[model samples]
Target chain A: MQVLARHNVAVSGVEGAPVIVFAHGFGCDQNMWRLVVPAFEADFQVVVFDYVGAGGSDLAAYDRDKYASLAGYASDVIEIVEHLDRAPVTFVGHSVSTMIGVLASIERPELFDRLVLLGPSARYIDDGDYVGGFSSADIDELLESMDSNYLGWSHAIAPAIMGNEEQPALAAELDESFCRTDPDIARRFAAATFLADNRADLPRVSVPTLVLQCRNDAIAPLSAGQYVRDHVPGATFGQLDASGHCPHLSAPAETAAAIGEFVRA
Target chain B: MTQRLEGLPADVLCGYLEVGDDGVVTSANDEFLRIVDRPHDEVVGAVSLSSLLAVGDRIYLETHFRPTLQLHGEVREIAMELVRPDGTKVPVLVSADMALGKGGQFMRTVVFEARDRRRYEQELLRARRAAEEAEGRARRLAQTLQQTFVPALVPDIPGLEVVGAYRPAGDGSEVGGDFYDVFQLHSGEWVVAVGDVCGKGVEAAVVTTFVRQSLRALAVQWDDPSQIIRALNTAMLQHGTDRFCTLVVLRLLKEDDDWLVTISSGGHPLPLLTTADGEISEVGASGSLVGVLAQPGLADARYVVGVGDSIVIFTDGVTEARGEAGSFGLEGVLGVLEAGVTSAGDLTDNLLQQVLDFQAGEARDDIAIVSIRVQDDADEAPAPAPRADVEAKDRALRALQELQELERLDEAE
Candidate 1:
C-alpha cells in the first residue's frame, strides 16, 4: 500500500537540507504544526502529514484493529521515515506523538538524528508513586466532552460550507478547514492517547532527545517532564516560557528558537 | 477587545475574560470572577486557564479546550468541571472567542453551567448503553441457535477423506443462514448437502434448520439427489414461509479404486474439481431455485473423484467476498484451488485462508467450505506447487536482492 497517499503526506523545503518530520497530536491534523513548520523551512527539509481518519487521509486505509493502540501510529511514523530518502530525521512529535516518536526511534534508531517531544508525557494515569496525572474517571469525562463538542461543532460548520455550494472547490476545501474528526474515531484516539502508559519505553530511546515542557501545562505536569529527563539517558529537558499544552501555537517563536538552539548544539 | 459580546441568555451565568496568547487571564468580568470563585484583583494577570479546574479537568482543558480556541479562533460548547471555592465540582459549558486587540491578540471567553443538559445527556447515554447491551445479548442467542444448525462432527466415512469448515459472517456477530452436513447412509452411500437461506438472523436460521431436516429425511428414502431436492421443495412450499434456500446435494459411491460423485443444485454455485496435476475446472449444472415454483427444476451431474482429485462445494458467500480489487468470483476461487492439495482438509483450509488473505480486512460474508478427496493407497499425496505463485515469489525476491545490491554500490561509491 502507498503509505504516503494513505497519510496525505506533504513534503517541502530546499532539497538536500537536513530532514525534519513533524507528527501532530490527537484531536487535529497536520494543521496543528502550521505555526511551527515554517520556521524550519529555510534550513531544513520539512515533512508534514496527517494521521489517518483525522485529516484529508485516505479513510479506507484506516484499520480499527491496527490503530487500537499507539504502536499503529508509531508504525506510520517509521513508514514515513523510511520514505524520507535522505539523512536521519529530526523528529518532532507533539502531545501523544511524543511517545509515538520514542517508540519509533527505539524500533529503528538509524532513521532519526534527534527526538523533540513537545509537551510529552509518558503516562497520563497516576500509578503507585508516579503522578502521571488524571484518573480513569477523568478520561471518561474527556471523551464525553469531546462528543458533545463535536456534535455542536458539526451542526454549526456543516451549513456554512453547504451555503457556498456555488463553488464546489471552496466547499471541498472547507470540509477539512476545521480539523474535525468523526466522533467514534476521535473517542478511540482520545482513549488511546490519555490511557497509554509508556514509562518502560523511556530507557530505550538511544538518540539525542529534547523534552520541551510548557510553563503552565495541565496535561503533562512539571513532575512528568522531570521524570522523562531522569529516565531517558542523556536527554535534556528545557522549559518553554509559554503556557497550555501547545506552545508551538501560543509561543511559536520561543518554541522554534529553543529547538534551533538544541539542534545546533 | 472591540467585538461586542451579545445574544446570550441573561439568566444564564456568562463569564468574560481577556486571555493572553500564553493563556493568562489578563482581564475578567464579575461573572468570570464568580465562576472561578476568585476575587477580581487576584484573578487578572495572575492565573492561566488550567488553574481554575481540578487536576483531571485541567488536563482536559489544556489538551482540548485552549488548543481548539487558539487554532480555530473560537471553541464552542466545551463542557468542563471547575473546582468551586467551597470544594464543589461545578459542571459548566465554556465557550471562548479570540481576536486581536491593541498590543497583542487576546481572547474573550464565557462560561455557562450545564447541569440540566448534563443530566439529560446522562439519561440518554444510559438508555443507549442499555439498548446496546440488549442487542449484544440477542445476537449471542442467535449465534447459539446457529451453532446447533450444523453438525458438531462430520461422521467418519470410510473410503473418503471429508473435511469442512464454516465461518460465520462478521466473526459470529450475526447468525449465518448457511449450513452443511455429511453422513453415511445404512446402504453404504455417503450423503452430503450444503445450503444457504435467502436472508439472515433468526428467520434465515429457522429456514436453514427446516432445509437441513427436509434434506436429511428425504435423502434416506430416495437415492437420486434430484428426487430428494424435489421433495424438499414440496416440503418448503407446504411449510408456507416467505423464505427460500439454495442447496447442493451430493451422493458418493466408492467403486473399485475410484469414487463416483453425483451432484444436483437448486440455484447454487457449481462445484470446483481439482485434478492430480493441479488444474481446476467447474463441474455440475445449474438448476431452478428450491421452493420457488411447484415443479422444481433441479438437475444432476456426474463427476469422478480419482486418486489425488478433490471436489469443493461452497455457499455464495465464498463467491461474493470482496477484496481490494473486487469480488472473488468463480475465477478467484479457481485461482485458489489450482494450487492443488494432498487431502480434503488441505484444500478446505487453503481456500479459506487464501480468500481471507486476498483482503486486508475481514471477510464480508458467511463462508461454508466442504472439500472431499478420494484418497490413494498412500494416506496423503504431496501437495502440488502452483507454478504462477511460485514464479511470482521468485521474481519479487530477485528484485529485492537487486535493490539491496544497488544500495550497497551507492554506499561504496
Candidate 2:
C-alpha cells in the first residue's frame, strides 16, 4: 500500500492476466508507454508507475541517498513487484529503465520472467575499449542541454526525434502529458543515468532477455544497444526499424508486436 | 507550380517514398528526391530509406523503424541525420506512416531540417551549464568562508556539557550576521554567548566578527556577565562602527559543588530556564542594544541550576521564525521548552529543530543556539582498573585524531 502510494502505481486490464510492467526512461514518466500499452491491455495486465520525482510519483518520497544511483530505482521496481504480489511477469523498460529492469531482475529474479530492454546501453560513456556512443564531453553537453532548455527539452529532443511534424499535437501532447520531470530530481537522475556503468551486471541476469535496438536513436545509439545484447547471457537481440530512443512511443505497434512475439516464444 | 496537399507545403522540406516489403525505396517525389540530396533516378527502385542514414542509424532501422513501419505503417519525429549527395549531413526530423495503394503496404517519410533549432538548443544548454557551474563555485566559496570564521564544532569540556550550533539562512547563498562562541576560561568557567548583529550581508557579518572578537577579549578581563557586556559596548563605541546588535553573555560558574549561571542581556530575547521538576520560565537581564549608545548599563541575573537541569540561549531567529502557519512566536518557543528535554545538547538541538521545522527546513534568518547542562553522573559505577582494552582504545583514539586531521586538510583544500 505504501509503495503503491509512493510511486503512484496504476494497474489496468484483466486482473488475473499475465502482468507486463512498463518503466519509462529518463526525462519521462509512465505515460511514455501510453502509445504501446493500449495494444497490450487486451492480452496482458498492464502495469505502469513513475519512479519518485518523475510523473505522478510523490516528489517527497525522493531521497537523495536512496536515489543517488540506479540501484535505488531498481529497489523501487522490486518493491512495486512485491507490492502487487506478482513476479516472473513480463518487464519492459525504455532507455535507463532498461538497465533498471536488469538490476531488478538480478536482485530479485523471482519478480521478473522476461526482460525487454528498449534502446538499452550497458554503458553510456566511452571507457577503455568499449564504444558506448557518447563521449564524456558529449554527456556534459547533454546535461547542459537539459539545464538550458527547460520546456525545449521535450520540445526539441522528444519532438525532433519523434518527428511530430505531421501531427504536432502528438509532440505537444507528450510535452504536456509526459517526460515532465522535477528539475532537481531530473538533474540528479541525469547524473546517475549517464555516469552509471552496469556492464558487470549484464551476464548475471538469469532471465530471458530481449533487446529492442531502435534505429537512429541518438540517446541510446545502435552500438550501445548491440553491446547490451552481446553481453547479457542468453539475450535475444532484435533490431527495430523505428528511429529514436523510444520505439514504444515513436513506433508503438511494431514495438509491441516484437514483445508479443518474443513473450509468446 | 504544383498544388500542395492540405497540410503539406513546398517550403516544408517534406518528402514521401514508397518503401516496399523488402524496405527498398521503389519510388519518390521530386521534393523527396531533393531532401535526400540524391538524384530521382538514383533513388527510384535502387535505394532504401535505411541507405540514407548513418550506419548506427541503419541498425536502428533494422530493429525499431522498419518493424514499426511494417506493423503500423507509420512513425513520428524520428531524429536522424540524412547524408546529402555532397556528403554533408542534414540533421532533420522525419515522420513516416503507411498509405495503401494498389501495391502492398508501403511507408512514406516526411523530413524537416533541424540545424537552426539544434544550434539554439545547444547555445541554451551551454548557458545553463555555465550558470550551474557559477552557482556551484559560489556555494563552495561561501561554505569555505563560513568555516574559516566560525568554529566548526563545539568545544568539548569535561563536567560542563555544551551544545552549540549555527544555521545560516536563505539557501546559504550569502553569509549571515549571526555568531556564537563556546570556550572555557582558564578559571574553570565556561563562557557561552549568542548574538545577532543588525542587518545582513558582509557589513552585518563584519560587525558580528567584531562582537565575537571583542567578547572573547573581554571575557579574559572579567568573569561577570554584565561587566563583559559593558566592556563590549565601550569597545564598539570606540571603534565608531555604525552598527548595533542583540547579545546574551552567560558565564557558567561552579561553587559549593553547584553550578550558577550569570547571564547579561543586550536587548535580546530572555533565555529559557527550566528546573528539574519541569518549572519553566524566561530568565535573563535586560538592556538597550549593544554598540549603539556611548553608555550601556546591562544587569546580571544569577540562578542556581541543579544537575539534569538546562537553560537555552538563542537569537531572535528562533522565536521570530516563519512557518506556513505564521511566526513561531514566544508561545510556540515556550511550548517546545515545556516538553522537557533530557540533556543540554539535546535541548539546544530540539529548540533549533522546532524553529527549523516550523519553517519546513527553511532558515530565513541566521540562528545560533547555546545549551549548557551539568553532568548527571551522581550515582555512577566505580571506575574500572586499566586493562588491555585501554591500550586498544588509546590506539583507536590516535587513529581517529589522524583521520580528523586528514579531514581538516581535505576541507582546507
lDDT of 1 by residue, A1-265 (tens): 4888888888888778998888888766787777887888898888988898777887787788878899999998999888776758999999999999999999999999999988888998888888877777777767666665444323333343344454566456543544566667877787788889999999999999999998767788787888888888899989998877888878888998988888767
Error of 1 at B253 (Å): 0.7
Q: Per-residue lDDT tens digits of candidate 2, residues B116-135?
A: 87677568767877788756
The local distance difference test score of model 1 is 0.77
lDDT of 1 by residue, B1-413 (tens): 69886644434457777788766789777776777787877789887767777554575566556665665556666666777778876767777777888858887788787778877866776777668876776666566656655666666555678888888877687777788888666788888888888888666766777787678789888888888888998999999978888888999998877888889888888788888888788777678788889987877888877877888999888888888878888877787676657778888898888777766548777889898887865564343333533443354344345435545755986
**DockQ of candidate model 2:** 0.16
TM-score for each model: 0.71, 0.72
RMSD of each: 12.4, 7.9
The lDDT values for all models are: 0.77, 0.75
Clashing pairs in 1: none
- The number of clashing residue pairs in each candidate reads 0, 25
lDDT of 2 by residue, A56-91 (tens): 888889899999999999999999999888777899
